[model samples]
Structure formats: C-alpha cells, structure tokens
Target: MRLIKRLLPAFSMAVASAAYPVEWSGNLAVEVRTFPSTAQWPEQKDNGLSLSFQPELRHRWNDGDQAFTFIPFVRVDSMDEERTHADIRELKYLHVADGWEVRAGIDKVFWGVTESQHLVDIVNQTDLIENIDGEDKLGQPMVRVTRVLEDGAIDLFLLPWFRERTFPGAEGRLRTPLVVDTDQARYESDAEQKHLDYALRWNQTIGAVDAALSWFDGTARDPELLPGTKGSESILIPYYPQLRQAGLEFQYTGEAWLWKLEAVHRDTEQEDYRAAVGGFEYTFVGIHDTPLDLGVLSEYHYDSRRLAANSPLQDDLFIGTRLTFNDTQSSEVLAGGIFDLDHAGKSFRVEASRRIGQSYKLSLEGQLFSDIASHDPLAAFAADDFIRIELTRYF
Candidate 1:
C-alpha cells in the first residue's frame, strides 16, 4: 500500500502538464480446477475456483519521449487464503532521451528464453500461489537506466526493496505435507527486505543471433525451506540468503529453426552451483497444405546440485509440440512433457486456447503426474492429476 501511494502521486505529477489522454486495457478471468484424485492432505480440497482482474493504464506525452504506466492485479480464491491477494503488476514512469532511457518505480523484468524453465530470470519474485510453473511474478521496485547503441544496449539497475515469494496455504492443493509459515521468515541481511540490490546487463543482437550477459547481487529470491515449529505443529520456515549470480541468455533465429539457451552460475554463503537449459525448436509452416503450423521443441535441463536441487528440473529432458491454426479465431494448442533421467519421473501438460467472438477467450489445461519415483522431489504430488478451465474477457 505504501508503494502504491508513493507511485500514484509521482505518476500524476509526471503527466499532469500534458493533455494526452490515458489509454486503458486489461482482462478479467475466471478459472476453475478439478482434481481427480483424493486430496493428499486433510485440509486440502478436491476442487478450486478463482477470479482475477488486471487493469492497465498508460499515458504518453512529449511526443512519446515520456510515459507513465500503471497496472494493478487482484485475485480471489475460494479455497486458499494465500491465493486471494492483490499486487501492483507495474507502476512506472519512463523518459526517453537521445541515446538513453530511464525507468523508475515498481515493474517486472524478464531475462530468459526457455519454454520449460527460466534459469536467468531473477528480477521479480515468484508468485507461487498463482501457478506451479513459476511464470507469474511479483513486481519489483527499481530505478533502471539503459544506454542504447547502434547494435547493443547496456542496462543498469538500482533495486531498493525486495518482495518475498508467495507460498500456498495449508488449505491449498499442490502443497507440501507441512505448511509454510511466512510470518517466521528469516533473512541473512541485517536490513532484510530493505536490503539494496543491484544488477547490470548487456544485450546485443548480431545478425541471426541475440545474446545477453547479466549479473546480480542481492538477496536470493528463492528461499530455503527450513523445518520449524509453529506452536505445536511442525511447519516450514523460509530462509533467504545473500547471493551473487551471473547469467547468460542466447538465441538464434532462422527461417525454420530457433535455438535458445539460458545458463546461470550462482554463489551463496552455503553453496555455489551452475545450471543451464538449452533447446532447439523447428517449425513446419503450412503443414499438409493447410493453414496450420506445427512446431517441435526439445530441451535439456542440467543442474550441478542434482538430487540436492531445489526444484525437480535437474537432469531432465523436455519435449513439446505447438500447433497454430492461422485462422480468424487464432486458435493454438501446446503439449509438453518432462522426463527425469535419474528418477524415471514424468510430468505432462496440455494447453489449448481459442478466441470466442471478439471480446472473450476460452482456455483449457491439463496436468498429469505419473511414474514418480519415491526418491524424486515431485513424488509427493503423484496422485494430484488435475485439469483447469479458464474464461477471459479483454477490454
């Protein structure tokens, strides 16, 4: 709330003198999920429903040299208290000059090019309650300066505040047996969330290839789940440590092939490790003499931590296919699976979406977990096969 209050006045002041009109756009969505298997925990539910709204407002003045943007998001869930929350997705002011640009306030920055996992994306905190894939993020407060060149750019960041990662409540499905107690969170820095962090990146595009190198020094976004006791019940406590990370992102674009790689080497007080994800995607345009295009994707994930890694993507192979129908409705379907090489675990997902009429869209998704070994990190959710349906209205 303090952040919102601070940014709103700044935004009004930045664009008050200009007579340009503000543009408004966003979406309202309702989502439903059903679990076929029984709940793993006694407090969990078999079905869940949520409603979310995100509205964006943008204003540009001084002939596109200056701009202000505000985006707010909120979600209400029927089953999980932690899932029902509100956030400022973006609230930033931008100033463009001859060869540089400056952005200030809370915003989101993404820095990876992978379909299965994002290894180099660390600017924003993960909104874990929204999804298990870690695609959603909470906005970060920063002041950024970018120096543009003929073929490359350099970005420098000054981050003032850190947002903690969200976790599923005890009543939420797809959670561990013991709930996470967020109130007991601990940090290595004396200032905790107020610790100042900084980062820099250099991005360049040379012909058919795009590459970026980045470095960050800050409190780690992902926390270590340490065992603790909340009253009489055992729970997990989040412990954040200071970290330094170096990341690289590479992509090659061709007529029919796309190659991507994201790698990171991170160091902390406790440990240091390297992880990477590399893949190639090939597209078959106008397959079978039709207007449909099919793309095949293959990726490999590797981590030095192996079994000691935090997530389940260590030493795994991912294969996926995307089908796009070049029609008026803009229909698409994506199916993918990850196979664990060491534990014989498999995770599969399918997603399909199509526009309805002019203002509405419908999407369906299914997740299947099978053949998980007992030693695998994802073995706890072996019985949690679920499907999701979503309806979104754009305005």
Candidate 2:
C-alpha cells in the first residue's frame, strides 16, 4: 500500500496531461492445466485452473513526441492462491526529443537475445509462479534515458525500487522441498527495498553483428536461498545481495543463420564469477517445396562455480528445433532440451501453439525432468512432469 501510494503521483501526472487522446484494448483468457504425474507434495492437489484478463491503454500526443501507456493484468486461479494475483505490467510516460528518449514509471526491459535463458537481462524481477521458465517478468519502477546517435545508442537506467521474484505457495506444484517465505526475505544493503540501482548500456550494429556492452551496479536479482523454519516447518529464506556486473551481448546474422552470445561477469562480497551462453541457429527455408521452415538450434552454457549447484544449466548444453508453418493462423511448434554434462541432469520441453478461428488461440506445452543428480537442487522436482493447455480469445 505504501508503494502504491508513493507511485500514485506519477500516475496522476500522466492522467492529467491533456497532450494526448486515449486508446484502449483488452483481452480475456481462460487457461487450464493437468498434472500427469502424482502430486509432488502433500500440500498440492492434482490439477490447476485459472483465468486471466489483460488490458492495454495508450495515449500519444504533442506531435507524437509524448506518449503514455498502461497495461494491467490479473489472473484468478482455483488451485493456487499465490498464482492468483494482479500486476501493473506497464504504466509509463515516454517522451522523445532531439535524439533523446525518456521513460518514467513501471516498465519491462529485455536485454538478452538467447533462446535457452537470459543471462544479462536483470532489470525486471522474475515472475516464477507464472511459469516454470524464467521468461515472465514483473514490471519495475524506473526512470530511463536514452541517447540515440548515428553510431549507436546509449541507455541509462535509474531503478528507484526493487521488485522481488515471486514463488509458488504451499499448495502449488513445481515447488521446492523448502518452501520460500517471500515476506521474511532479507537484503544485504542498509537501504533495503528502497535501494536505488543504476545501469548503463551502449548498443551498436557493426557489419553483420548487433552488439551491446552493459554494466550494472546495484542489488543482484538472483536471491541466495537460505535455510529457515516457519513454525517448525523448514523453509528457505531468500537473501538479496548487492553486486556489480558487466555484460557483453552480440548477435551475428547471415542468410538463414544466426549466432548469439551473451556473457556476464559479476563481483560480490561473497563470490566473483563469470558465466556465458553461446549458440547458433540455422534455418531451412521452404522445406521440401512447402511453406514451412525448420530451424535447428544448439547452445552451450558454462558457469564458474559448479559445486552444490542450483542452476540446472550451470555447465550444460542445449539443443532445440523450431518448426514454423506459414499459414493464416501463424502456427509454430518447438522442441528443446538441456543436458547437464557434469551432473548428468537433463530437462526437455515440447510446446506448440496455433490460432483458432479469427479471435482465438490455443497452446500446448509439456515438460520433463530426468536423471537429476542428488547434488543438484532440481532433483527435488524431478518427478513433477506435466502437460498444460491454454486457450485465449482476443478482442
């Protein structure tokens, strides 16, 4: 409530600006999931059901130099209380003038281009309860400035408040043995949640490569899990620490082929390490005289610290394929898996999606975790394999 109250002034300023006319659009979706395997824990049930609503509003005026946008999202779940939540995905004011752009309010920023995982993308917190994959992110409160030049672009970010990552509740599947108590989490900095973080990125395209060099000095997004007790029940206490990170991202483009590299080095009081994910993809266009295209992808991920590892892909290899069917519905199917070379752990995913009729869409996804080593944290949820389906109707 305090945070909402503090940020209301920004919202009011955007609303009071008469420089623009408003345009709005929204969508309502119903999604369901089934757990093919038995219950991973006693607190969770067998299946999950949910409904979501998302609406987007935009206003642009002042000769298109100023703009405002609001995207609000909510999901109601029958199986998990924690998953049934709402978010102000994007509510910001943007202005552009003289090769300069500024954005203020809650927004999402993506920095990396790899398919397997994001290494240098740390602006927004992960919405882990939304999906097993770490793709979904929580909007962050920030004020950003970008300078556009002929050679390249430089972006500066001022993060006022930090948003913690979300986790599943007790009655949710795909959770760890030691449940996480987000409310009891601790921060290493004296300023706590109000710590202001800063980041800078200079991006440019040279020849066939689009590359960026970034540096971040602030609180680390990845929290260190610590052991605790919740009224005799063991739990994990997430601890957020302060750190500095430098990242390099590059993508080389060619005819029907792409090479991507995302690498980062970080320094903290406790540890200093470097990690990288490098991969390439080659596509077969118009396969067999058909309109469909098949893309083959392979990536290798390496981390410096590997003992008692929490990351499933600490020292792993990933291989995947994407099949795109050139049709009116815009359908696509993807199959991917990651292999942990050192720990003999592996995880596979199969996903497909297609549009239905004119205003509806359907999606199916399945995940399997296999041969998880005891030293790895993923061994706890190895038995939790399930297939999920979702249908969305756009307005």
Q: Best by lDDT, which number?
A: 1
TM-score of model 1 vs. true structure: 0.95
Which 10 successive residues of model 1 have the least lDDT summed?
Answer: 13-22
Task: Give Cα-based local distance difference scores for all models.
Answer: 0.93, 0.90
Candidate 1 CA-lDDT value: 0.93
lDDT per residue for candidate 1 within 1-395, as digits (tens), equals 99999999888866774468788999999999898998878888888899999999998989999999999999999989999999999999999999999999999999988898988999999999988889999989999999998789999999999899899898888787789999999999999999999999999999999999999999999999999999999999999999999999999999999999999999999999999999999999999999999999999999999999987988999999999998898999999999999888999999999999999999999999999988888986887788999999999
- lDDT per residue (tens digit) for residues 53-113 in model 2: 9999988888879889899999999988999999999999999999999999999999987
Deviating ranges (above 4 Å) for candidate 1: 1-18
- Provide the TM-score for each candidate, comma-separated: 0.95, 0.93
Listed per model in order, the count of residue pairs whose N, CA or C atoms clash below 3 Å is 0, 0
